[model samples]
Target: MASGQKKKWVDKMVFRAALRRWAQAARASHRMELSELREHRTRARRLRAHLDKLIHVAEERLALPMIGNQAFPRPVDTDWAWRPELWCGPLPVPGMSSVASQSMLGDEATMFHDCAQSELTLRQVRNTREADLAAYGLRMDVFRFDGSYLSLAIDLPEEASRGLKRSHLIRIDTIVEMEKPLEIFARLNIKHGPNTEQIVRELPLHEADINVEFDLAYTKLNEKRVEKLWLDLIFEGPEMNQVVLRDLTFSRRKRAAL
Candidate 1:
């Protein structure tokens, strides 16, 4: 046989000898060895259970349509869409996305009650019912209101920094359910450098008219100076009202130039 083959045979023989010695040692302590083997098997079972749970979690995560950590779903349009309730998460802050006795409006949103002697609570609710809009909605409960200027403000995405032109039309669609009939207004505010322009529209009483469009062409928008944009949903005679905002969405499209 070749020298290399002979050396490999010798190495295999040495490995077998070591295994035989180990087996003999284990057999010599048969009872203790059996207990150790049983313990190892139990540990393996526990590890498998943990692994199964991890796999389940991973599967659920994969089932979601989110591209990354974004909680909202993607819109069919190629432009931007925002769902505040879903964007935050399942359990949102009580005051902002959720309403509790002492909860206040959440971050990235604000409320003005300069001269109020009332209570305001906001909460985010999961929409389990079938809907094409969002998986979540906001509920705002107001009681004993006494403020001169009252408005709930929500900030838009930072992508607005890209710039907005007079040729674009901002559209807002929302589903509002109120305990009592009241007038609610939607205002779009655009800040450009040192100037701020606002377009206001009264929400129609007809449920079908819950959509509003703001043509930037009608406003003095310095396209290059555009900094940020926000929306304010104002309520009239909102005292002792339970307003449930089922869905809110914003989109932009080029206006058909005249």
Candidate 2:
């Protein structure tokens, strides 16, 4: 072959080699950027752990309880305005996800989720107190969320509701305080099927978080209709009080031995 022809062939081979090298370099650059992004995500996860630890320490000192610990964290919905104090963490930058776990939903303060709802605003009446009781050493600070719609909901799980029947006795340990003497009426909503039926009963207003027994003899849990139930402790008259509902539990009306 002529020298000129040979030289042209060499040039073509060199150009192809250069193009391949450039393509490889581009791929390597993309991989490095991807790796860096992954590292950043890992670092953010560590930061979340650190922030949660700080919250736990602070709550221990102030006696504040968080919402959930081991349970799955709830995605932020209407909670952006006022999150539980313990959830204060580095603001999640856009394009990043925040990790959370169910921590302390059952404390003195109001809880606002389904796992352990202790809504501070779950008073039976919107702005009134029972007629026969006065505030009895119940202390709470309005230092937190002003839109205090934190009404507590007592969740009756499916299993519990299924086992429950009419005439079943329920033992409750609660603290009711009133500003004046009046009788407090308790309104309970037992959800049966797709319907919500209300049952109203009266309890004497005592100025203390007291223990009471709710005899289900008259409650008449419609076996065919009773799906689940929630109680609303209604303060009949005007007496500003905080009722510390400790627990609302049930005991089967055990059959007597023959």
Candidate 3:
């Protein structure tokens, strides 16, 4: 037998022996804490029931669409595409509404406010309807707003940091349903060097007005100085409103050179 092969076999045996000892120690600990484990199980069942009831209430009030298995759209010559909501499973912090601003919707999204008297809640709803063609959507409910400004900021994934250039066109597509007619704006922010550039566009009221494209060439984008990218959804007069964002996607493509 080779010396190296013998050493490998001895190492494997030692690992197995260590694992066995650990498992035996774990079993003994579990036996000693069996009563505490039983109490934990009982509490866990109650928590599960409460969570189920909460989900039921959300479905009743929100009436979200069913989850679907459909693909999102992309522009021709697409270099990058991202669907923020459907990128992962359900959000850990599903809903929050209060006077204090927070970022409970995971690391990728944040909500900010400067209102003295207002309430805001954001949650991910299951998309069951086929028309949505997406797995999830964000529902934002607001009331009694007296804020200077409020916005939902979504951090783009790391894929966006591929060194954007002036020749790239960034497109934002969204489906919005509001309880009342309200002015909403979408802002694209790009951080380059020590400066940040912003491009703002008001979302149209009609369903047909669902897309906006930002021409990087129009801005002073230092191609070599590109750092980060993000999007902001700014709401104006959002009092007593329920806004459902059925879908939001971003795509980038090269602009046609004249």
Top-lDDT structure, candidate number? 3
C-alpha lDDT score of every prediction, in listed order: 0.69, 0.41, 0.80
Q: Quote the positional error of residue 18 for candidate 2 in Å.
A: 68
Judged by TM-score relative to the true structure, which candidate is superior, 2 or 3? 3
Winner on lDDT between 2 and 3 is 3
TM-score of each: 0.65, 0.36, 0.71
Model 3 lowest lDDT segment of ten: 61-70
Residue 118 in candidate 1, Cα distance off native in Å: 2.7
The TM-score of predicted model 1 comes to 0.65
Residues 123-143 of candidate 3: C-alpha lDDT, one tens digit per residue? 787766647656688888997
lDDT of 3: 0.80
lDDT of 2 at 248: 30
- Give the better candidate number (1 or 3) by TM-score: 3
lDDT, residue 196, candidate 3:
96
Candidate 3 local lDDT, residue 113: 90
> In model 1, how many backbone clashes occur?
11
